[model samples]
Target chain A: MSVELDIILSFKDKMFRLAHRITGSYEDAKDIVQESLIRLWKMADKIDKYANPEALAITITKNLSLDWIKSKNNRINKMQIEEYENVLVSKEFSPEKSIEINQLHEMILKLIDSLPAQQKIIFQLRDIEGLTNKEIAEILKVNENIVKINLSRARKKIRELLTKIYNYYEN
Target chain B: MKIEELIEKYFEAETTPEEENILKEYFTSANYDKKLEIYRQYFIFLNSERNIVPGNFLPASILNENSKSKTSFNILSYKWLAIAASFLIIFIIAFTYFKSNVNNAAIVITNENFNEFKDLGTEVTFDAFFKISEYMEYVKSSINDIQAVNETFQILQTYNLMNYQ
Candidate 1:
């Protein structure tokens, strides 16, 4: 394949992960990736007009993912928040000290999902996607400081809640 | 410096992504410190999530469409270039014709007597000189017509003399 196609394919999973994090639906994320690829393909000849094609692809995926959310008028439902809060403070410390690591991982994932949209996406880009603050800022069209601050907030919240869950088990 | 210190720095949101990657590697390794076990699952989850690729995506269709559009763009550009070249050629030919006409309009009369008239300063002299030149052209054409008629008369006289003989 051509160099442009190679570059685009290299970032396919990155775009997919970003979309999946933002929209929280595998199907919507896949659609967003498809749309992004089509757009990049159309501009393939002029792709160099973008200083960073990977960033351009991510920005398009982010915008389309947000559009999907806005069109559906959906936020993380109240039930999910209640579930998250209950998980954080539940007093059911089974003395059976052998809790599965997978369960803890699921709990952390839910806690991440419970964060505000901006903080959650910032955290996702930084931690799970392994992107730099500047890269996330460019993709989200925000200042680097804003990305850093939001990421800090996200990490603090998740760490605090996870600590609470661990404390409950300890007690 | 220590892994525990780095983990604390990470929670405080003071660690760079490179440092975080180190933490990730340490936690996901088989021999992470038992004291750091609390953060192990989170790191493993992040690693797993990062590894999650979308299923079976083939962009052959997109590449095909892209190639088609590229071909059409080249053709359109070539067509526009041809039109531009044709217009440039026409403009050059018309400009040369107009420039030659301007040069002919400014031709200087070259008679020796006219040199004396050149000292008669002011634009009026040049205007009068041009008028004189036009009149001279008319006189010259008239003389040529008279010469042609005289030749015809001579021929008629020769024929009359022959009949008399």
Candidate 2:
């Protein structure tokens, strides 16, 4: 295989996972990954236009996923808010003590879902995907300081939300 | 960095990944202070939630699609060739039909010698009719028969030559 194909194949799964995490829709994520690959393939010969092809693919995936969400929301604007929460929340908890922890996890996820789009993305890339600040910055087309600031703000919000939940359970 | 400064930087969102890793390690350890327990569960949540196993390989069709489109430029070039060939085909067919019809008409007029001139609407004499008809027929036949198509082909060849050069 050519070097471009090799890179695409190696990162395709990671791109899928990133899209899935962002959209919470497996089908949409898969479609976005495929589209991103096709776009990269088309531009492979002129890749000198980009600093990093991997980052370019990632940016494409992110933009496509966000566009999918926008169109989906437009179609299903009447969907109940909790329905979305239920789709995102893990329902694998129904025990005596574990149920409480599960609720906490759900609350955390809800808070994450409530974050501003950029902060949420920053937190997801840095904390969950385990990418470096520089990688996140390049992929998102921002500076490293912006990545740090967004991540910090996202963490602060999660901390505040989780602290509230903890206090509520304790009292 | 010292533990105190690390905690301060952690809350301030200024910690490097290395420092963050150290903090995660310290928080998850059993011997960590109880007052900082809130931070531990948060890290645990981040660690646990990130376990989304990237599920499947890229579909075979995706890779196949790239290979399939490698010949797209060839197809595009053939598109132009097909269009040019079609125009040339139509030109040949039309030209042959028109030239043969003209030749056949010329032969009939020359052989008949104005036998059908009675249908003429003019009140002219036979001599006038015969002379005019014969001269016109001769002019038409010579114009069509004397290498008209050959001259057109030569012009077309020069067009192609100019394009190549």
Candidate 3:
């Protein structure tokens, strides 16, 4: 149990980032990652056979996150990603500076959440989690070119949205 | 490379990780071109997103369950120990009870035998006393008869002398 738990904990942050990118909620991401680790723990014996356990864990988290979204949709009460951004915004902050910064972060998160799932994950993995395109492709089981294309689209869309907001504020 | 060139490369998603780092540094430093100020917030958000962790929300039940399993293992061992101790106690009690009953039975048998032997001795002594009394009476009767026979013999001698005179 110790060995398995340690192995799972090593991937905790990475798995959370992947899940968070998909689910757009810290709480949901935590649940998804926890479930992914549990599943990994169940297959601890065969996990060594996989060359990249991290990638396997990420894939598992990604699928569970998608499943979470599906189940939420089936319930007909899908939660807004902005609600989770509010949770992220409520953290300890200095009065004026922290509020503005948190709002900016929240707005950026909301914008990122608007991207399609593939583009969103690629952007998170590359720009935020700081993984190489090759690694992202490996984790996604897609080609490096696809990963690049999605990342480019994600960055362009976010930049386009930000420019609109900035110009509006300037006016 | 020029900051403008790096910014263009960044939006194009063609910047290397190092080049992106330089872009992030330039934007966050707030010394970049005024036109790039909008992108500064975006880069700042990215930098902040990197530090955002799930933070101690890894489901306490998992870790708690592990501890609970360890506790349950200890409890299982204690349960077996308690059962074994109970068995040992029962065995000792049963052995003591059997030994005491056997000793009591042996004592009762010895006492019953001693009482039977006393009753048989008393009966034999009474029979012997009765037999001795009967033998003494017979001897006395024979002595009397002998005395009578002597007197008769004297009388016969007196009668024969008178006839001769």
CA deviation > 4 Å runs, candidate 3: A45-49, A71-103, A169-171, B29-35, B59-61, B77-165
lDDT of 1 at A61: 83
TM-score comparison, 2 vs 3, better candidate: 3
Model 3 lDDT per residue over B42-127, tens place: 88888877877777655566677667766988999999999999999999999999988976753232666877767665776688
Error of 1 at A7 (Å): 1.5
Which candidate's lDDT is highest? 1
Give lDDT tens digits, candidate 2, residues B35-133: 666667777777776665556656566567666676677888899899999999999999999998975663233436655654452445566889889
Q: Please, what are the lDDT tens digits per residue for candidate 1 over residues A52-78?
A: 898888888888887887887666522
Query: Interface RMSDs of all predictions?
Result: 2.4, 3.2, 2.4
Model 2 spans > 4 angstroms off? A45-50, A74-101, B1-8, B28-31, B65-165
Clashing pairs in 1: none
* Comparison by lDDT, 1 against 3, better one: 1
- What is the TM-score of candidate 1? 0.65
lDDT by residue (tens digit), candidate 1, B1-165: 899899789977789878998998899899898755678877888888889999878566785765776687788899999999999999999999999897676535568657665675446678889989999999999898899989899999999999998
Candidate closer to the true structure by TM-score (higher is better), 1 or 2: 1
CA lDDT scores, all candidates in order: 0.79, 0.72, 0.77
Q: Estimate the lDDT of model 3.
A: 0.77
Looking at candidate 2 chain A, the ten consecutive residues that score lowest on lDDT are: A90-99
lDDT of 2 by residue, A1-171 (tens): 567677666667667767776676677778888888877777777765677776777788888877877777633323343553454333533432233555566666666665666776778777777778899998888989998888888787776665654564445
